[model samples]
Target: MSTPSHAAATAPRRRNETVIVFALSLAAMVVSMMQTLPVPILGLIRTDLGTSTAGVSWVTTATLLSAAVFTPLLGRFGDQHGKKPTLVAVLGVMVAGSVIAALATSLPLLILGRVLQGAATAIFPLALSVLREEVRPQKLPGAMALVSGTLAFGSGLALVATGLLTSGSDADYRDAFWMATGFAVLALLAVALLVPAPRHKTGGRTDFLGALTLGTALLLLLLPISQGHEWGWASPRTLGGFAGAAVMTAVWVLVERKVDEPLVDMRMFVHRPVLMANLAGILVGFGMFANFLGVSYLVQMPEALTGYGFDASILRASVQFLLPGAIISLLASPLGGRLVSRRGPRAALGLAAVLGAVGFAWLALDHRHSASVIGAGLVVGAAVSFGYAAMPAVIMASVPHHQSGIANGINSISRSTGSAIGSAVVTTILASRTLDHLPPGVPPLPAESGFTLTFGIGAAAFALVAVISRFGLRGGHTTVAAAEPAAADHSGRPTDKAVRTDTADAAV
Candidate 1:
């Protein structure tokens, strides 16, 4: 149906789109790897840096707090200025941070490096915006799913890689950071070379006040969530953190309502579908971290002392137990994309909920066998991929093209917050119930019942995901629709090709 010139033009465009997607996926994977890289080597880090457990905890905590502060602000910046520049700058920061982390001699320097790496969380939302600009409507869901799947895949892969690298007696934690640096360099090059400039930038003033208040609220909430195990649930510091978060959250809302160009729109934030998607993000995030921590701890328990478990070394647990699920998640992503494209994100979310519940139920009831645990983890991994695939669709469909990056950024924050809560909950639950009658001078080990209870709690979280999908997300499915005639490009000139994709309902 096309002339030779038309066909030739289309082929390269398609190739370019493919490159863009690949680059974005790499960047997204790197962001997830940053979160999990130091996890398996925290012990080594503490020993090498001569820091206490509480001091080493900052390696992870610094990244979380940094992401909470920077994701939305940078996301909005990309939306207003340009995605490509923002992405390149973020990746640059990640590379520098990785280098510093790899070379650090003290805990403070390592934490500073992690803080910069954490700012790259903005890459995910900015990547999504780039997809919206370039990919065709028919192929968009698949592209988004592939990139989203990398989050789960990268998370598990980082654990495995860290285990392998640190398996020797003389292993240095800095080796993990070197690996991160290599990946960050690759991602930076791929993105800078392949991705095109933005065509739909919406110039606006940054809302510094709203950004500050929101960042403070998240910091307060996450500080308690991450540290409650050390602080004690009833401690004044923990209680004060919760109260402070609540008050700052109220202040953030007020600031957003008053700002002319807000960091987050109050109405859109409260929209039923968006609200439900965020709720699902939290539950899914919780289940994801819970699965990782609970399974890792359970399998590594010494069988002789615990009366259960496989006594898996960190390497064996990461490679033999967790790697399969991570691979399955990557493999299932295209299917999830197809599911989202055909059945809508709501249906995909429902399927994720069912699968997650089933997977956790299997683990809770029959975790004694390796086959059962691996098979169950595979299912949960796929469920996470599906949930990740569906969330961006809901967010992209609910917000205008101009607000896509910031909106998705907010959703990403919700998931991170949930992950922090999940880690804290697991720590508290396992510590609360340990084996009785342990030998003198032997460290406490979690009872088998603790594993069961943890999995049960994970199942409940997924069940909540189902409830949200069924009751909260209502109305017809919507994908990216063509931009209205009045839509303007970065130059303030009308553009026919730009899309403003949002869900439409007579009532909603």
Candidate 2:
């Protein structure tokens, strides 16, 4: 059924497919690392940049805002234009951002660099879109699970790497950016060489007005959530930002309803399964971040005085408390993929909630010792892996294959939003409660009760996600539904030559 030349061409493509998955998975891990890489060294960055604490906070805030805005837009663009080019472009920009941050001598320069790096948030959904086109449906679940699992791996790796790199107070910290640069360079090269061009393009026009309004709305909403602690929760700026976001969102909705080709299709967005999955993303994200920030801070509490913590430095905290959980999450991903394949995402989500609740409850009752904290984290880490793996599976199964980019991008935003909220909540609770008996000028640490309360809240969040997943996701293999007939002639579609080759392989 195949000529010698055709067989040769098909053989190379089949070989390249495995390479493509490996490259994208590594890229996903690296980009996730970039998201949390700056948190541990914030004090050093503030001092080095010679900026006030509030000013230096922008280093993280800038990336969050940029990610929130660009992720979905770029995803939609990739669907309409070309995914491989878009992926390469996004990785290239991340590389450039890493360089900018590495050389940055001022706060604005560093913030600018982080903003550019934020563009890579779009990569996750675009990677998913690519996988949809290149990998077969039966293999899709496993490949996606690997990529999704890397997110947890990257987060943990970032903490350990940050600790190792910034061991001394005088450590340049710029070395971290250089590390990001190296990873970006590798990911960029891998994507360029191994990833085949998109197999389908939406071939539609951009909706500039919808994009502008949505961007404005997200910017306004995320600002108060990320900065509201400093601005005062009830301050005019915070409240006004929320109000403006509400107004802009209403307008954006109306505009999307009327647009010929909106930035996001409201119909796909409002589907029961899609809406439920996005909501689950927010809840699960809240629980996972609470675990990460809470444990990192908890271990750093001064054991000599706090009576509950090890009084470890950032490096020790990362090693003792964070590293184990991340490694567990990495392992849990493939297990999760098997579960998803056999049972379904709903089961996976339900298990995540049960495990998270148990982990948080364990910490809530017995967190005085470091082993207890780390032990609880190991369980919760698996929960996070399952949750992350399920979210995209739930999403991809519900939407047309072509919309995977934008749909997953929006889902990513929901998680980002939840992380912001979790950070703000934990920070406020820790700061608001303090130890009464202290030496003069000794900084306050969160009361043990505060952490207990936070963990209890995290348990509740996870439990809610379980409930949502049970009711929200549609029950069926929608894989066939995702492959629309219109995709047959798109630039990303398989040629007759390639189709015949695929058929022959299937027969064999």
What are the TM-scores, per candidate, against the unseen true structure? 0.95, 0.92
Candidate 1 least-lDDT 10 residues: 492-501
Per-residue CA lDDT of model 1 for 1-508, tens digit only, reads 8999999999998999899999999999999999989999999999999999889999999999999999999999999999999999999999999999999999999999999999999999999989988998788888999999999999999999999999998999999999999999999999999999888878979999999999999999999899989888889999999999999999999999887888988766876767888999999999889989888998899888888899999999999888898888889889989988877787788889999999999999999999999999999999999999999988777666777888889999999998998999998999999999789999888999999999999999999998877777765554544232224444322233322333553121
lDDT of 2 by residue, 239-336 (tens): 99999999999999999989877887787788666788899888877887899899888888887777778778999988889999999998998888
> All models: lDDT?
0.89, 0.83
The positional error of residue 488 in candidate 1, measured at the CA in angstroms, is 12
Candidate 2 CA-lDDT value: 0.83
Top lDDT: which candidate number?
Answer: 1
